[model samples]
Target: MTETPQEQTAADGSVAMQAGRDVIVTNTTGLTLMEARQVAIDVFNANFIRLADEAASIASARADALREKFFDRLSRENPEGLQQAKDPGFQHAFYTAQKEQARTGDADLGDMLVDLLVDRTKHSERDIRQIVLDESLNTAPKLTNGQTAALSLIFLLRYTRNNSLLSHNALGEYFDKYVKPLASKLATSTASFQHLEFTGCGAVGAFQFLPEQSLENNYRGLFLKGFDPQEINDRDISIGLDRRVFMPCLNDAAKLQVSALNEESLESHLASLSIPGEDVTKIKGLFNATKMNHEEIRAKCVELRPYMETVFDAWSSSNMKNFTLTSVGIAIGHANIKRIIGEEFADLSIWIN
Candidate 1:
């Protein structure tokens, strides 16, 4: 015959134990074994729920922070444009930016989203601006940080110009502060251009394939007004000026030369101002035209060798000649640059249509 169970109660009446074919235990809380097991499950679930709540709270805080930042920038930069936030399109984009910021925890991307939103208010083309904002928000998150960096570097090199005269020392400081950081984040492979093309940021093609004759014709029509045939021929011979050399072989060195000439022109414009002795010495030391020559340009190139190597690596990796940024590309590139550096360096007006 099976033995009958024996039960014992603790002095405090908080626990009970039973001895039988199967022993059962109770807790100090007066819970039976089965009740205690259910309590334990509840506790476990509560802990997980708390953790999930914490994560959600963090995401909410991030989203709120981004929203605050967007409003701050908007109020400061375009106070009257605050009415833009009332538009359905702008509201939709702002909501999307907030959601993405919460989801991705990327504050920089949030800034770019808001930047696009602010830019939208500046344009009168409502439908076009809406499309651009929607498409840009959709594509911006898809880009890796490295790819975004590549776009900014290209934009800086190809599209932008300094608004004010800067001494060589100032230029060097800007390069180190702004350009170098972007270069450091460039993708290792030229295939990045293909990715940019795939994302509708740009097109990768040979520069030679562009409408060269038309461009040359337009150039001659606009700027070749009073030049003599002999002078034109001499200029052409000096630079090997043709469609082939015009675009395809255009490199950083030529671009730098053009920049140097612009700086010289600016300096000449300001030559009448009488600066103090130390200021004059500093300016001359930094921008003396007589000292600016092939060797100086070569030295600048050497200073930029590492960054240029990354650029060459991208080209060699894909064997691509040129990448042209579409409007979408410009928007994203400008935003990324603004995030990496600041508005002072990443001027959107330069690329505005």
Candidate 2:
């Protein structure tokens, strides 16, 4: 590998301000700065990012609560209360219910506004407050705010309560198939509360912004690692850092991104998906099926069960299932089909070892 150029520290590398407040970077570490003031800027930025992440998490929790509250009460699944559901006054009642729910949260959500509001001064609270308290009672199809906003959230729960996206039957099927099984798992899970893979923690794509943003994240890291903040920042010039160290790191960052690295199987959120309950039901029914009476077939079934179950487990992530096929998807899918349709159809065992 070609060596990084900026990592070549000078013979007597020292970073100090001789004249004024201008910052400079020195040394070979290629990671941090060498000035007190610059270090302070990083400190400030890191703290800001932390606070921002917390606020984002809280806002996400509130939106989830709102979705649940609306669907639970007004969902027009199959009901004896069709008269009120069909009544023209239902729109008013729905909005009124939402307003009431906003003011008073249920047992699951604790107190919606009170529980979610991290700090009064945070800008997120203002947005949430507007969402909760702003009275847009009119249920017309057009814009109710009397402005032609570019891209604003338009929630039409009143219109969809009967049969659209939130159709009672579709939700019920989804609940039974995808959600109900995960309810217990989620309740006990401490893994950053994944609401369909978008965690309350951090998620970002390819972002291009001012170097200040980069400094925000890195400055905090330096402080946390017990580096001498002043010494580090004093020698670290943004220009040298950007050209010599930072730019190079950016080019190689993607390779080091994920928690682990392996070539065992390529995985994608897309590819074909296995039937959810088929493997489980097969395992459950295997106890009674006369189809397994043949000892040879029975042994093969037993051997294939784990792979089938793995397919089931891997495919269970709703956030992952998509339209594309990956190497990982193919392996699991072939196994799943073998288990489901019998080995006569899926002659894939030869490819496994």
Candidate 3:
């Protein structure tokens, strides 16, 4: 029997977060404003790099398991055909399946009779197209059956994991110590409003107010900022990415439906974003107009102080602590996508800071 996958505690969910939490906790609290800011930045960079390694390791293990299972099923079902499917002839067979799919619009490519004849996989469209083209060609194909199979397994693991980094309960005890020293510095910084409100948003009180809010938007924002969804662009590792929030509303039975949402569904959701607040608008406009240097940003921050003050008041208040994105903060946040981003997310509407 298996070891039940080692039920991950709130503590051991993410190694990066564990490290970050430790760094923050271990670092002294009496530092100056600049020192505290540097500490936060250091934590961010360490977590970013750590998440990259963790994501790759997770992908590798998931791929290995999938590869074994895929071939094992083939061995049990058709021992003789499994060997034959490795040859170039399988490419031709895949084309035949594609032709049939095109003609009849049948999904599953007639029970996946061809090696590379999948209509869809839990991978990117670009990756799927590359595999399809490789299989269609007769000579010097870019991918072989085994290679494509391995790639498919990796892609499946990535898609299911949600973005590049695997998220379990992050921001556990790590930030608890740092929240105070960092709060004043963060409050003065662009990130003040978002971080201030983030703490209470995860509470049951938040759900009571924004009951009609989409489950995705609920946990997807400020609270989960540390969860990096690192993007891989042609082997380049671009940091500062955020991912979709997990199944906040769904039980185990409906989890499959959440994973089944296709690219079209994702696009539909992306097209609709919240409107930005005046502060975010001004910051974005200044940014777009003149590159938004530090002096200008500082000036804008002064003007935006009242809005941040409201957020600070709510955070201090016991009753209204678990509030949604207040009308005052979103504008500044919308335009101020620098480090102010509660989660380093770029796709905010007016509602989120």
Steric clashes per prediction: 0, 19, 9
Residue-wise C-alpha lDDT for candidate 1, range 245-309, written one tens digit per residue: 12211122222111122334424533544434454333333323223333334344345444644
Question: Where does the lowest 10-residue lDDT sum fall in candidate 3?
Answer: 222-231
Q: What is the lDDT of residue 203 in candidate 3?
A: 18
What are the per-residue Cα lDDT tens digits for candidate 2 across 1-353? 78544433434444432212222323323222123223323222222223266665654354346534333322332222222222223323233333333333333222222112111112222343223221222111111111101001000100001112122244345334322332323211222213212311112223322212221222211111111223223433222212211111111332111110111110121112232343323321321221112233223322433232322233233212221222222222232222222222322223222
lDDT agreement of model 1 with the native: 0.53
Cα-based TM-score, every candidate: 0.57, 0.15, 0.17
Cα lDDT computed for each candidate against the true fold: 0.53, 0.25, 0.28
Q: For residue 154, what is the lDDT in candidate 1?
A: 67
**Cα lDDT over the full model 3:** 0.28
* lDDT by residue for model 3 (162-269), tens: 232112223122122212222333222223323334422111144322111221222222112111122112213222111231222122222111111223333343
Better of 2 and 3 by lDDT: 3
For candidate 1, which ten residues in a row score worst on lDDT?
A: 216-225
- Candidate with more favorable, higher lDDT: 1 or 2: 1
For model 2, the local distance difference test gives: 0.25
